[model samples]
Target: MRKVLLILVLCTAMLSAQEKPGESRFLLRGYAHSGVEVRGDETTFVGGSFNPIFLWRQSDKLLFEAELEVEYENGETLIGLEYANMSYIINDYATLRLGKFLLPFGTFAAKLHPAWINRLSSKPLGFGHDGVGPARDLGVELRGGIPLGEAKMTYSVYMINGPALNDGTNPNVEPEEAGMLLYDLGEDNNNNKAIGGRVSFLPLSNSSMEIGFSGLYGKVGNVESKYEDVAALLYAVDFSYVSKVSFLSGVVDIKAQLNGVQVDDASYFNVEDSSNYSFSNKSSAYYVQMSYRPVNMSTDFLNSLEFVGRYSELSFPEGALWTSDQTQYAFGLNYWVDWRTVVKLSYQFADTGAHESEGEEGEASNDAIFLHWAFGF
Candidate 1:
């Protein structure tokens, strides 16, 4: 990965040299956030990660963009690349992106993950590595925007290295993680590639509302492994609406999404207790949120405040040994210092239901309070 980045940098130099003076330039931009959180009885500060984005425009047809993440985890500082891609414009309506990039599986992961734009300090439930979908992946994709009369439409489609399914057949694999799918498997484990895309439509001429549908189908098994034939079909439906309501004298925003994942059934052996198990491998998650800001209020302080609430849930297959159901509720109030800066106070609680086959382990009190400050630069 380092060698590839170096080569891209050299290519950028070559492109810049060929361009007329002042025709090429570079920009640095991204968002950072810091906060305090009280999760159950544990308290900590959330400043462990920093994200930076780099953009270089080498003429109109050629451009390069990359995002790097630096974080402290488990006693060490780690640097990781979220995406490093070069884009070539095919025309006014289409562009091709090559290298690692954020997957457009849903609107939130690809478009609204920035700290200042997320409206809340924490991400919705059913997201992240072991959740519903992938954050990013390596491959190439085609993206475009189209005008359909007064309404607008946008799309993205791509193919990437196959995701790996953890069957927990090996001694190192945990029984609870057996049916999970890992998108960042580092390298391809089979000859097949994963293909997926997202399409969103704005039906109104004002573009105040959007509806989206996304899907991905791929083989998630190693070629020679016992679960080689296992495959997965994943899909999501999402929607967003933002507008000012005259009656309330405020702006209301609503966002929601549902995710479904189905993997081909495969037998899993628990190496710990010498047991075997298998079940219909299916998982699903969903969340709904609504927020209101009194932009039309006479008092500036009242106008700058926003109220938010959300509910989310994650459901795993029932028979899996480590399977569990998770439900979460979050509420927040935010004060905008400016267009790009905000202070947030929020509270959230989570409920986890243990796998039925393993019986109950008692519902643990998983709740949190957050005080965050976010900015975009």
Candidate 2:
């Protein structure tokens, strides 16, 4: 804990001493989300997520950002850090960032920005805060944008050297671990490291498309005899289109993994066949969503009273993977309260596959409707 505080202090001191002309601003912002969640079996959980953020910009190229979040469930409170980072711009084409920041991975991971709250679902199916990966990591990142005539290209590259696992599952009692890959290797030094990028192109004034791919490979150092480290691969693609009648958008995501028990001289699984098993798991899902804003600049309601709908499906084969199929549909009406706030009402349904022992057809999923208030600055 002391080390974490020390690092934050050092980053803050560095940014305070460097400031460009007319490039200083301090801002505070936040929002809260409360709603009832119903599962496929009709179980309901009433909960809410409240996040508060603070940002300081010393210059157009140097800035500090942070967020603190608390999730409330009944009378219990779960508190944690969401973001704390200091960024330095090298030039118009590059920026160097240090401290804890969001890992630039899947589209949903980075796009889950706080201010853009109401524009999305109460929960994004399998992304951040959903058990896959931690929201932020301690590391350094490089990100920037390039110009191409009337259109532009954007990119991000990052390397994190903190907790290898996001679930507080690390076995190390020390602050940070570093060493070699073989002689000094062993299981003592397990850390998280990754690299990824994104590219977008605009062929028209109101329409644009993007494709992204990211890979994460690391090990959770200490594990029980029956569990080995994990190697994972993830792929994603996304697109969005805008027009007078409606807007169309979609995303496809896939994940595959390989993992097992570690081996030693006295280890169980050997070259010969054995009862122990190694597993290969794969899961993928996709969604097509569209919304129609009947009111436009030339119409009444001024873009209010819009209607939106979405459909998504996910499936995993029945082998080593926890096989299941899920389908979700949502409909909503949104009214713009002001330039930076909006009110929304929505309904959603989800269905999951059944086990062979159940022996009956799966039942229709439960439905939920919610009213949401959102704002950002």
How accurate locally, in lDDT, is each candidate? 0.85, 0.53
Q: Which stretches of candidate 2 lie over 4 Å from their true place?
A: 1-23, 35-47, 112-120, 131-135, 161-189, 203-207, 218-230, 243-275, 297-302, 354-364
lDDT of 2 by residue, 1-377 (tens): 99999999998977876653456898888776654444445645456677788889987878999888788776889887777899998998898988877766545545644634435444434332322333456677888777767666667777664223212123352211111011112123343453434454555543344444444444433344222354334445555554553342222122221111111211122123333323234445556656665543554475555566767665443322234556677777777676667677778877776534446454567577766666665
Q: Candidate 1: misplaced stretches above 4 Å?
A: 1-21, 172-175, 355-362
How well does model 2 score by local distance difference test?
A: 0.53
Maximum-lDDT candidate? 1
Over all chains combined, what TM-score does candidate 1 have? Answer: 0.90
* Model 2 residue 270 lDDT score: 19
